[model samples]
Target chain A: MMRQEAMGVLARANLEELRGALGAWPEPPDAESLRGPEAGLIMLRGRAGGGGAPFNLGEATVARATVRLSSGEVGFSCVLGRDLEKARLAALFDALWQREAEVVDMHLLTLVRERLAGQIERTAEETAATRVNFFTMIRGEDE
Target chain B: MYVAVKGGERAIRNAHRLLADKRRGPRNLPDITLEQIASQLALSVDRIMAEGSLYDRDLAALAMKQARGDLIEAIFLVRAYRTTAPRFGFSEPIDTSKMSIERRVSATFKDLPGGQLLGSTFDYTHRLLDPTLQGAEIEQAARADVTDEDRPMPRVTDLLAHEELIEGDGEAEEGAEVGDLTREPLSFPAERDLRLQTLARGDEGFLLGLGYSTQRGYSRTHPFVGEIRVGMVEVEIEIPELGFTVSIGEIQVTECQMVTQFQGSAKAPPQFTRGYGLVFGQGERKAMAMSLVDRALRAREFGEDVVAPAQDEEFVLSHSDNVQSTGFVEHLKLPHYVDFQAELDLVRRMRREYEDRTADEGKEAAE
Candidate 1:
């Protein structure tokens, strides 16, 4: 998979999910923290008319981290909410993926994508079930 | 007037202590957990988060609990925390078109492309309180039926715009400077961007009342609900080195599009003007009210006179922030002893002078 796609999957993964995905690895890689696993805020933006000029809607808490591996690959994580551990683990996984794409894709990206798809599928099915089946009444006849 | 009095330190300390005790209520009752507040009283948290202009669910829940369920106070707490929190950057504008909609319905069209899916709404339910819910153990929800046909959910406005039936062309100005009210102070004749930012975090009751005023013919807008969708949308941000937008995560949002009637001129045909509202969570009432106020505010854009408070941008935008309103109003609770003492002395002196003048006039009359 592409780097952006891989990063997107990693960023969306939660702390427990990211931790569970790490179990597939043989051992932790030689990674050093290049930057902090610090919590911060990101202002989420929206459009004026949902399709017009952009404006600030609100801010969401985010935790980010950057890691550099012995192999000279740099990994970064920027996920929603303030979970420093999740950011650190995701950064480490990014580094691991740069070296071993196949292994990471096989265990992590595929699973995350499938889980996301499953959620959308579930919501879509449930939403469709509640589709309104209404009967139109003639206004003058009713009157 | 500038006299500073001391000796309230001990009173203040004891007041806080009393407040803490009161917050706990009875010692026998268990403390309400943040998780419980976040889940059980979710709408309250949603309001707090939206009005506070912060989107951390857990923090909002904590604020609610700390404020003892006073939602406005909770919003104030969250707003205070937002100022101290470090800001990373702004995400790209969220696309509601590709939203994974959970609840979507249109009042204008009955059989629109996306069928009206009433996803977890309280619209049709009887308002009577369910006493059984006090200690109810709910059963598992029924499984949804599997479907292979993937129906595309298009915006109702987009459909009308295809035939040139709406005011907005539905095309955003490319490379336009996005306004951030935090970065700069909002000024007069504010564009739609700044107006949207203010309305997004504006007080629900204020907007609701203003919107209702428009309905009561204050600034009549024959409005129809084009669509209202509650769903999850992906938030993407561009990384400097990556050279591509990366999805941070999904956020639940509520969106409403209101269409109002506009008459055609001699050269132009009549078209439906649009108003938009988008909030952080499942804030349906806020969204609806915001859309109404938004359309009314567009009176000037449509060459109509701004005769109502809702149509007046300055009035709506200036007093919309409940935090600011609360600060100015609630500050009356603070000590104003010196100011009041000055008024007291002035009134006494005025009364003495008036009595002296009246006594002189009485003596002259007697003579």
Candidate 2:
């Protein structure tokens, strides 16, 4: 069953679990600490940054998270938002799914995927809106 | 009509079976053998090995067969597999000067030390469709053996050095610098090393097209094949524990050194400058294209104005990888309905607001 779940994730290109386990956190996540499977006790060391790249004041806050599943999957998640705890929880659930196949009910997959899609859309919208600021680059005739 | 809720697990299982069937369509047909692909379609295997950055011919052949002869897909397969393999150590640079020359030619010099062996090349042959080759093996040509005393293997660069037609080789730079492409994201205005690394894994078709553009007056720096040599070179690696170098298995390589004429500058008197190109197996076209592009990219180093697509670092490096290009191109097939829905809602709201404002303006004007 575990092998089957792993294959499913692999074929689907849902390698977030493997990436998180590699401890490839953009920056240390800052969320509520969560115990993981392969990884012992894990916690998010979140920070407001540009996907781990250095950011200054007035820049958008990016949330990061880390966790470990009971089945020994050390996972980390980085998402752009102010909800550090939610990001951490999502990452933990993802890692838990990686370790424990039974946790990945069909209902859960659909729910998580829907939530992620919504979040992505919101993020994209925000980014696009932010790009449209300078309203006046008027032509010389107007001047 | 009333419908029952379908189980997700069952739907997933059915999808998997369908995909499997698609991948292996009509199993009643004969299975494709890796060896058949490797031997019959050697050129495709060569391409995969060249782009994949792995030297395993068998694996490349297998990838090609599995990808249904899609060379780019095979390259992607090899590249993905290559990432998983552990890096042991770097091989000592193969000295091409000592290559057991099967085919060596220099277009620049007429009668150099090593008399140019025309070797196996389609350059002189008429591009006629030979119907006989479809089913028959042509009789082999008689081999000739010239004595060692008559043979002269002098490099064309040696002649240039004598005539003072080119700058002398500078002392080798200290320290082996690490390439940044595999580790960090590609940045604009790349350094020489980064540019070379990017070019090495670049899509052959893209590079060839850009190279052709340069020839057609896009960024013309007249280039000539100074030398194109194809042969096996020994691979050696030094073990720190043993304190001596040991031989690793040899691999075939095709090397092309292009000499291009550049205008002289105050700091450096320009004669003919060199651009080096090397790739695994007998891949002359790739090597020549690489050499041309390499020379084109050296514009900044030579203080020449970078003007064309071939001379642009960001343009070249960003669009180089076949894998990245293929993935991003094909990823459009994946579900993006949610994003589309959001976009739809946004457009609807904006239209409604515009219509309401316009209606108010119309009413006021009528009043």
- Model 2, B200-306: lDDT tens per residue? 56778988898788889988978888888776555544545335554433456677777787568786565887665667667888878877887788788787798
Model 2 TM-score is 0.65
lDDT of 2 at A69: 53
TM-scores for all candidates?
A: 0.95, 0.65
Q: What local lDDT does model 2 show for residue B196?
A: 57
Measured by DockQ, the strongest candidate is 1
**i-RMSD per candidate, Å:** 1.7, 24.8
Please name the candidate that would achieve the greatest TM-score relative to the true structure: 1
Off by over 4 Å in 1: A140-143, B1-4, B146-151, B357-367
User: Any residue pairs clashing in model 1, and if so which?
Assistant: none
